[model samples]
Target chain A: MTNKLLYLSQADVKSVGLTMAEIIEATEKGFMEMGNNRVEMPPKPGIHPGEGGDNFIHAMPAFIPAMDAAGVKWVSGYPGNQQKGLPYINGLLILNDPETGLPLSVMDCSWITAMRTAAASAVSAKYLARPESSTIGILACGVQGHTNLEAMNVLFPLKKVMAYDPSPENAEKLARFGKETLGLEVTIVSDPKDAVTGCDIVVTSGPILKVPHATIQAGWLNEGTFVSCVDFDSFFSREALKEAAKWTTDNLDQYNHYKDKVGFFVDCPGVYAELGELVTGKKKGRENATEKNFAANLGLAMEDMAVAPLIYKKAAEKNIGTWLTL
Target chain B: MTNKLLYLSQADVKSVGLTMAEIIEATEKGFMEMGNNRVEMPPKPGIHPGEGGDNFIHAMPAFIPAMDAAGVKWVSGYPGNQQKGLPYINGLLILNDPETGLPLSVMDCSWITAMRTAAASAVSAKYLARPESSTIGILACGVQGHTNLEAMNVLFPLKKVMAYDPSPENAEKLARFGKETLGLEVTIVSDPKDAVTGCDIVVTSGPILKVPHATIQAGWLNEGTFVSCVDFDSFFSREALKEAAKWTTDNLDQYNHYKDKVGFFVDCPGVYAELGELVTGKKKGRENATEKNFAANLGLAMEDMAVAPLIYKKAAEKNIGTWLTL
Candidate 1:
């Protein structure tokens, strides 16, 4: 049998220039599919190698029947890579044809991870955030912080953003990127409280660590604000989580697994509904216009499966990648 | 960062011309590492899509600390592929640099699976089988059957093979392969009973089904015959498994997982030792020449990880595959 696979590098995928709107739409659909019970995503299997078991490589596999997408993403997070001047996170995604079980494309997943993660939070915001939300507060000015801002613009008419980073240089870099790339008014705040106070939407995209400290306090959030903690509650205070009218996660299985690993979800208020259930209308998203909602999105393989196939289709249509026979 | 990955096709891997003995040694070494608790192999995560869930795609990721090798094998088995003139089993293996978490090579896993699986059986025979074996009995004349014979010849001085298949044409094909490739005298038997009776080594390598039924029975073997059931318990009778003096599996977790799914391991005799323990000398292999030993190998990711890097090194030295920068 002759099977030729398309190889899309990070550069090639960048050249394809997938729009944030497209990714958000697809990611929302993926969450809807999950809520509707049309997807099969097992809890990722992980292997921790190297010293101290600090470095981890996880295998995330999923099948979305509605999208006819099946694939696995092999991703790694090495905290020590910073010392060696290498990327802290890198991965590869293999997309397979659901019918034939043949790999259609192998693409660098750094872009996919960044885009899908941001899109998940954006989708949660679309359902949970208040209408006519304008200002946004972002914690940790990194890839997730920047992409989260870009994704929020798809569904909200945001005019300004209050950004904060522990590193002042990174905060300035994110501010410049926001002004140049997204053309939004950006303010670099010195304190986490200044960054989060009185914002319509709040996003904590900081690095995940073992120790949990209250960063965003309960008193900082404004009324009717939507909070999305993409970093597994590392930045959100337990008091802040308890103060929310409704709290949810992307998937229950993954949330519990990580909760066991790091004590985050166990101490927080009970999850009222998963984001998928709200997206699919299986459960209520916001009970009232004044209700405060908090969503913890750990990300999902279904999101990657949904978005990778679209990128593959776009790359193939544009003839943007190297093709090799197997 | 110039992360270029090597790609080895099925043809490229076949051209590597890996010797059966080398693979057996590496696979045995891998088992020893597993027995020594030097490898991290999470249970495989699988996705079963479509109706009836007859087809399955599994992600097997493993890290061997001793080998300093890490990888994941994405494999699929579709029973319906035969109707569409496609191979039932197709897969790919991606080898990553354990230290840097960057992919080094992506190779076709069909060859690796066949060779490593056969090598595992050969390793079991080296420890479990009688040293003075002269004849072998093989159930099912497929890839496993032919490769098992080739691998067994590396450790045993077998004079002839008794082969069986439900179809006469396949029986003849296996007989020809045994004669032409292995230079062994082969007899195609009409019944499973005739094929397995009074042989020094018996291997039940047939297609696994949902229902468990008896195929190879207790009375159809010699007193000290080494029995290896590579296809779960589909071919071996419970009575035969009970008759053995000692029974073992490659991995206890996987065996129990399948036991929950198919009700095989629960009814069998208690496991004396895993193959790794035997290879590591942590446990005994055979107590005496008259003792009967049974092995059930459920195919581990460590086997693929152990063999794929050797093939990658060979391909790199020979400059035998396409390289793409990621």
Candidate 2:
């Protein structure tokens, strides 16, 4: 029978007050479950509506048998939306009961995407970064840059951040946020090398696609530095990636799916281990403090599935979303 | 900015009273647009959640550029749901503005699926069946049987109907509905052969997948009989498909995707044309009244896209459905 469905708006999701620590732990649990083979995640199917294929809407569906949760996220990204005064990416996620296949809640996915993606990087940092990591480098200072900093700050006790962006105004804005809101010393740099050089943690959160740009060289990374690439290998040089003592990804299947198109990791060093393997103790993370480790997390649906239930639970407890009859 | 989105329930959709003729015409127009290269349809991506893959949830997305309608339908079919007193299939569809990628409406897709599937068969029948068809035979009397009859009744002035089902009680129910609702002379037969022996149009609406059962032979079909198989070659013999003067499908890409898995359509005769080709006048349908033709309508998202806008409009005019802000 048709029933009333919970609908969480963007404001409601934000009002749920999900902390970075909570999201990171939730996402890590998803990775552990995935390693245990308790998650069913299909490769996302995408629709390219624009003629040039510059934009995409992808359907991400996953079922976590352990949690008895199933859901699908319909998310879209259009680079051109920025110029039109709209968000670059917008999405909606529907959570359903795995047993009956009945929808329980629908929520805005933009916040989830931002938080979960950042949490993925933070999880990698927690496992791979040095315990004394205090300085961070962030290229492409945007929403991801800020969120990633927030996620990493919780684990690393970061004190200083080096940021870079093509646009000076945007870079200055992020620097201001880091210094004022986050209470961390920040430096705005024009050259990308200034961001990654000599930093304890380096993150590349720039635009994705095949673009001819300056790459981070191996010489810029310190021996104990940890690197997280969420932008499809755009910033890291092939030399830097190959030189790391350990290289990993969020999921192997997704890594291989984009390996050819993103034009990286074709014949690089074998993957050290997936994030899940590390979380589940199937593989080691950092054996020594000086070991250079790198992680490439092509975000997975299992993480979204993990965090959506949290949001749904929180929203329900707080009674913070619209309820509509179906 | 978020806006109010239309939400149409099953009752609201039914209250719209969308005529069978309107749906058939809309479905045909979608085919014509697809043939003219004005629609963007990706292969439906599916997730098998049930253990052993007994149940599946599929995502179907389409953008009809000509009509400026874009949407995605999330549909699930769980055969085991019947034992739990739930319907075998349930779905929801979201229509969006193509220009901004903003969702405009969310509606129940159960009624849409039922109507569009029957309309697909009717479209094929209109283009391929004889114009003066009178007598109809239906196998596997179910919702499809009734819907297909409703669609075909608009195209033909039917006088007599012959129906058969594995369950005689179901067959008698359909017979009663035919005699009482449509005022046609209805006959309930025990044998599948008795239903199709001298019918003008024969429709096989049985269950899908590989099954061993009675197959309708070529001898059972008259010279001018037009056969439509909603089932995947279950009730009809491979020889019947091979002996037809012409055979076509709703979409070639989807047909080929399932051709090997379904274990039919391999080593079969070359497909004469797709339904779109006939709708666009790129290929002939029935060249003569005596020609025996066959069509397999696998159902398509373009048909759903066609009919959803109609439902949205009708709901808007009648002030029906709940409006939810997202």
Candidate 3:
């Protein structure tokens, strides 16, 4: 038997309305499950266009052994998604019958990618960011930028947020949304330094830089602040990153896989511990909150694995999404 | 931005009573495409049940370089698909937008697998079976057994067919289908030796014997007859299989993958030259019909790749199945 599929638009996920705080808890639990080998996640290696920015598809399926859930999420990336006015990443997550090898449901994975990516940053912040970290520097206020702000603000005490973007209109809109939706003190910064300076958290989420721009000078990074880069080039030095108390990653295999695919980011090599490894006690967590401590990225399949069941549950309860039977 | 998805049912594949034959030609071409690096296929690692049998999931996406066609097929096999009143394997083939990574179609692939597996048997017989072969020994008359008869009868000029099954009724039905539908002389045998004796072609399809039964004996295997096995255990003797003119398979890697997972048949060791390598001249097809030969049981992903486009084309031409827009 095939599983019933749910079709969700952007409105449906927002209707289910999982706040970022709940998201962080769920995701952290997912990491712990993965650390214990209680989750099924394998690197989704497909085709790449080499250095030419080729089209690629990824099927990231995970079964959270602790939670008793299985999900298969497939996503594709191409530069052309932008040209067609589409989000560059497109995908669907199929929740499945692990025993029967039958799919249970197919749901929209675009928002899952967006929400999970931000939630992973929050996962890092849960263990890495200062508890009272109130000031955050937001770089590149696009889809990722907006979600990052929401994810961070939901889990941490953020009294002030700053954003930097090349587009003045994007910065102004991000400022408006931050204040109106999130109720935080917002600043539209003229310079990246204005965004990065004196902040307890620094978030970098952007496209691959073409000319290798430097926004975080080695001297400019805030001492004892948590910095997370969804993009690899966000930080330049081991010293710049090691200032924090801990180094945490979503998954080591995934990061290493990307390292092989996308290459080393600014020569900062290795990690202190993957978040899963930390959760499993294979490595230690933050020794102190004030050292330039927690660092990580988002390649976690369980984050989506963790969230799909929630979406499936809420959608079924609400009679939401598309339905098909096999 | 969004790819239009076409859905194909099992009913959509029936056309001209020769869809299976067409499927074989497409698979032959597909293998050549794979060897030329024109297809996007990789080894599909799967679940190990830690029981008596292991299952697999194969994800094959192909872009026919000459035809400018692209599709991806995902198939999963659990040893128990039959016991559950379903096919032993199930999957779907998806056609996609090349530039956007948008899925364009979802098709029922159980029938496709049955067809393609039989098609490979047909292709093997075309090259390796004796030119004047008139009689065939059809073993284990179940789903695989029946469909394989269709492929064999269509590909070769045969005068008589024999059947052997534990269930005499199933064997009788197989014999009837061969004579009534395929228009051939048929005999139902009480013993496997009775069926295998004096046959010019041997097509063995069935489950591995749980407790060894003597369907095939090493001494009774005929020289100058094409011997093909559709199950892992049937390939017991490399020397016996090699008694024919050519040795081949559908895909060497997939066969090897299964070999690695299950280990080689205890009896056969010189299983060389897959069907594709033979078709592409990397290995020889048939030096002479009288030479002893064997084509080991191997399933290829390209056959799955080939039919996705065919189904897409057929579904569109006939306006069959459902359409979903993403």
Candidate 4:
């Protein structure tokens, strides 16, 4: 009968001390649920603001019955915010009690979004990437670059990281984190092709754009490399996508939804399978070591649902957040 | 660059003291914006929980550029909650700074939803109903019934109310409010037809159902009667809906979206115009005195966006809410 719900700030969410491995495991479980047809997720409904119509606020809602998680994540991504010294993405996540449909917790979505997105890519790479993959090429060395590096390091025996960013300062910052915090050899590549040609796994984490200014060329990627595109075709050219032996996505319905409306995937290679299908063994993953693999993992609300409840429980146990009454 | 947002509970929202007249005016402005193509409102995306799939949580987001309003209302409706001594609908509205896309306030959505929904109905009737409207009939004697009565009282003169509910206690409650608060002649009608037969304005506030158990039949409505359906075709039969000379809705796209997916309004009359068109004078309302006009106002997020910012400003000026840092 209590109407109090826990509220966690961005700092409080980080204080919960969730590991990259834990987030990857949770995100994989969500995809497994999806593969088994146990979750409900509608393609995100969004509104574009500003004159250029590039900034967006999306309402993503999902329900995973097996996880007992049901809620909505109201998040915004304003590429213009970076010029104002604000984060590019910010929002909140509301987790509801499955039985009564009452909000149980409200938490900052930035931290969860940052970690879960990289975790999804990590989950995809685990099934698609070569087992002996030791080098990673990361584009756009922002929050996603750092988190994706951390996540990939958890699954692969990464020996060195090649980072590329339009801003040398951002690339240097990520390089420092990779060398000091993760204890890996890091290289800052001036050309985007230098970052992609020799690496065994490549991750493109640039902003999703309505009109892509893609730089990665068709023949740039090494043979047997696995490519994870967190950004929606903004970093990879159409020819580059077609060069892959098999291209998969996190969710086929969501990819098709955005492709039709936003005009992202135009005349590109057809998706071979959803990541969930690969996770549940419903489809094959990296059948041969020499076959190039690619996955465009547009984030899903179910991934947030998968990770948020765990954070809420941990924060409650540690007494780390404020409880506000409704 | 402040990351703090005002949080108002339900009591704090009530303390702001927004009148029905103000709410009606604001809702009218929202409709005008819709008609003028100045607002961005996507069809609501929802998730149905529970085994029976009757419980729902919907994310309604809108941006009204002229009003400088942008936000999302996360609301849930569980009919089973009534038996558990909980309100059937509970939610929170988060208003964001349109310039920076940072949240400015978070407030309870129940009060705003109730008031704005009725205000929309009243606005519809203002254009569609006879100018000398006196008697009003309300179908469900719940929160919407009382609010609808209050809204109708603001726009009409010297009225009587015919209240109908399956439960006599609820009807009695609404009857008491009509007589004591509004000082109107009130009657509790046992038959649904009695509530609709002689009224100038009829309001149906029943629960929105996937499979509607319609009771009101064709020929039940009187000539020159204006019908407002807050619920989705749950009270009025298809024949009753077809009986209207002119049929309109709050938003045509939303109505069609739901109609295709939820199987409501199957084989019903085609809509003549949106309520926004009527508000903006693009379409006629009631051209003749003998015409029966009907409008189904499936509540819009733009309506909430219209009312919520006003409450936030008032509550801030009064220092009536908690400021929580993000």
Q: Evaluated with DockQ, which candidate comes out highest? A: 1
Candidate-wise lDDT, in order: 0.87, 0.83, 0.69, 0.90
Candidate 4 lDDT, tens digit per residue, A1-326? 55887889899999999899999999999999999999999778877778788788999999999888999998998878989999888898988887777888888999999999999999999889998999999999988899999999999999999999999999999999999999999999999998899999999988777677889988999899998888878887778888888888998888998899768877778899999999999998988888889888889999999999999999999999888878
Q: How closely does chain A match the true chain A in each prediction, as TM-score?
A: 0.97, 0.95, 0.91, 0.97
Query: What are the clashing pairs of model 2?
Result: none
* Model 3: residues with Cα > 4 Å off, grouped in runs: A1-19, A48-53, A209-214, A234-239, A242-245, A260-262, B9-18, B47-63, B67-71, B80-86, B208-215, B233-239, B242-245
Poorest 10 consecutive residues of model 2 chain A by lDDT?
Answer: A260-269
Tens-digit lDDT track for model 2 on A1-326?
33567888788899999998999998988998999988888778766676687777778888887766688888888777888887778777878766656667778889999999999999988889998899999999888998998899989889999999888887988898899888999998888888887799988888875652437876888888898887867786667766788889999988877776656555556778999999998998899978888888989888888899889888889998988755
Give lDDT tens digits, candidate 1, residues B34-84: 999999999899888667888888999999988878989999888888898
True-vs-predicted CA distance for residue A53, candidate 3, Å: 5.8
Scored by TM-score, the top model is 1
On lDDT, who's better, 2 or 3? 2
When 1 and 3 are scored with TM-score, the better candidate is 1
Model 2 CA deviation exceeding 4 Å by range? A172-183, A187-191, A238-242, A262-271, B176-183, B262-270
Q: Per-prediction count of colliding residue pairs? A: 0, 0, 23, 0
Q: Of the native A-B interface contacts, what share survives in model 4?
A: 0.56
iRMS values for every prediction? 0.9, 1.8, 3.2, 0.9
Model 3: CAPRI class: acceptable
All candidates: TM-score: 0.97, 0.93, 0.91, 0.94
- Encode model 2's per-residue lDDT on B138-212: one tens digit a residue: 998998998888888888888889999989888988898888988889998888888888898988998885652
Clashing pairs in 4: none
lDDT of 3 by residue, A1-326 (tens): 55344555455666777777777778888888877877656556454432364677766656675665665666778876777777678766656555566655656678878888888888777777778899999888888789889999987889898899888888888888899999999988888888877998888876755234555776666766877787665534455553445666777777776556665544554577888776667776655755775565756667887887787778779887666544
